[model samples]
Target: MQTIWLTEAEWFAILRIGLGLWWLESWRHKDKKDWFAGGGIRWASGIADKHRWPFVRRGFDLVVKPRPRLMAYIVAYAELALGLGLVVGFLTPIALTASLVLSLIYLVLMIHDWAEQGQNLMMALISAVGLFGASWRSWALDDTFGLFLQ
Candidate 1:
């Protein structure tokens, strides 16, 4: 293989780290006070209410609407945690999988919004690539701690 400045593993690690930074950026841009006060969840609920899919509306009302505050906290903190985990490679596979799931959920919920769907699609793709590449093996703490390495 033609090598660059870094080995293949290192490059993959960089990709993983970049994705982690994206998650961090997502978390950083949120207004925590308003999000914690249920503003974010309320906004999502409003979208769900108007969604063309009946399943989206019913599922949200059943799972999120009844607990707006809790869901808000979950969504906000989950981003932070996933970002930290991925950046440090503390739990790369878990972080990548969780991010994939979250991205898929976001993709589905915002299917009507073409603009936001792009980010969701990219996140999901990156998560899958990083997970399959074992990106943590190079610059990740997972390697140092010997976590999930056969």
Candidate 2:
């Protein structure tokens, strides 16, 4: 069999696109009514209620409960923006960092669910890899446009 090797840039591109699509698909499937004002809040509250971390529980109570609609909109739009940024290879470092943060938050909030929490952890790790690789400029719009340099 022939050996197949991928360059660091190619690997980063794949990770970026994959993670972007994951977020994009998640946002696409959400219904505004349910997510912003109805079932989604209830589901999230249930999970928050079960969260073992007192800080996370308090955060949920202080922020999510007080302004769930605003939070929902923020989450949805952030997901969309991050997904688009990754897919288009724009502001890649920022997108990756945001992905990592969001993933960690999910992992912490959903600590009771091993499967979901594991996925969140994996996503966080992937984001870390993408960030540390610093290959965002290799095939990205940011490189083309000379934006978000670091």
Candidate 3:
């Protein structure tokens, strides 16, 4: 068996780029015009209906419930901020944390509504947390100057 060694810097860079791109890709996919085929509202409403956390779900529904067009815009913009923040490494720790939090929320929603896909969402949430350390440095400007974890 052959062995390959990578320094902390290398490992950090790899994880940062990989996870950043993952976030960016997710945001891009969700931003597509026909992403939900005009069903985004129904889909969000359905998830709201199945939620076990009443307060949180109700809050989500209130924000995403009134007008779906507005909901879509809010969702898309939130994702865009998350994605760009991750990719740019401007606020690496905060970005990664937000990603993890959002992933966990989605995981719960998926589990409540689509049990079969719960595992996938769970895995994503786990991966997001796992990559947190790496997400702190490397490709980020924070790494370049030491502003990240402070």
Best by TM-score: 1
Candidate 3 lDDT score at position 100: 73
Estimate, for each residue in 64-108, the C-alpha lDDT of model 2 and write its tens digit: 888877888888888899889888888899899999999998888
**Looking at model 3, which ten-residue stretch has the lowest summed lDDT?**
118-127
Residue pairs in candidate 2 whose N, alpha carbon or C atoms collide under 3 angstroms = none
lDDT of 3 by residue, 33-144 (tens): 7544446667767777877788757877677677777667666666677667666677777766776777776666666557646544653654465365565555677678
Please, what is the whole-model Cα lDDT of each candidate in the order they appear? 0.92, 0.83, 0.64
| Top candidate, metric lDDT | 1
Alpha-carbon deviation at 150 in model 3, angstroms: 6.8
Better of 1 and 2 by TM-score: 1
Off by over 4 Å in 2: 1-5, 148-150
Sliding window of 10 residues with minimal summed lDDT for model 2 = 1-10
Residue 90 lDDT in candidate 1: 83
Can you give the lDDT of residue 147 in candidate 3?
Answer: 80
In model 3, the Cα lDDT at residue 134 comes to 60
User: How well does each candidate superpose onto the true structure, as a TM-score?
Assistant: 0.96, 0.90, 0.71
Ranking by lDDT: 1, 2, 3
